[model samples]
Target: MKHQTERQAWMEILAKSSVVNIERQVQTLGKLPEYSFLRSPEIGLTMLRGRAGGTGEVFNLGEMTITRCVVKILDTIGFGYVGGRSKRHAELAAVCDGLLQQNEWSFTVQNQVIQPLQTIIQQKQEQQQRQTEATKVEFFTMLRGE
Candidate 1:
């Protein structure tokens, strides 16, 4: 259960990270351990949904392109599902995912790859929010008519 939670957290990070960033992080691990693909990376579509007004009603938003794969490293199996058409990114993410499940590599991956990617994501989001906030418009009720 504990491992599941940690896996979910890292998966979320991997899902959001760019292809280049994820690929780069995986490369930093030097020579990767032996892994066999249980499911080769493949492209697919996922149905997206959204709420009417944040919480009012749910509706089909659209379909999104995604690539996913399953891989085995020793006894552990790792899954990777990421957006877009980057097959290599999906493969690398799966490899990293398998490594992360092992206690021997979990600490290193969490500290090096997952956490750093998360920080990069957070900074990008914050910068976007600031840019959006800067464009806010204000209106006054009483003007020339008064």
Candidate 2:
């Protein structure tokens, strides 16, 4: 159970790390087979330039490039590189790329990996909601030094 807790914690971290909308990501992920595994989408930051008042002024805003890999963990058949261009990103894609293909990892991947990943994702969202609710503030005036 504790290992499950730890695994859930990591999944939560990975889920929160991406800028891609998590619910949409999960929904899209659910459409795939149960044993399938999707790597955490890679996201990158970019600079965009814009002008104010019809080109009277210019400014820059940061943007992100997001890439996701969807794979059948059973067949190890999946595609990588949906968004950003980073070697590390590509390497992460590659690990998923390879594991998704191998048959030997199937059971271990499904039980130890994918199921826990989904569970943690759900747990993290609930924890976030609880934290947000806990922070709600109420104001009141108090009698002096009572």
Q: How far is candidate 2 from the true structure (C-alpha RMSD, Å)?
A: 12.3
Best of the candidates, TM-score: 1
Clash pairs for candidate 2? 67-83, 76-100, 76-101
Question: For model 1, how many clashes?
Answer: 0
Q: Which residue runs of candidate 1 sit more than 4 Å off their true CA positions?
A: 1-4
Question: Model 2, 84-126: lDDT tens per residue?
Answer: 5443443333333444345664345445444555666678889
Candidate 2 regions off by >4 Å? 1-62, 67-77, 81-86, 97-104, 136-146
lDDT at position 97, candidate 2: 40
- Each model's lDDT comes to 0.88, 0.48
Error (Å) of candidate 2 at residue 125 is 1.8
Clashes of each: 0, 3
For residues 28-136, what per-residue lDDT tens digits would candidate 1 score against the true structure?
Answer: 7777778999999999999999999989899999999999989998678988899998888788788778889998888888878999999999999999999999999
* lDDT score, candidate 1, position 28: 77
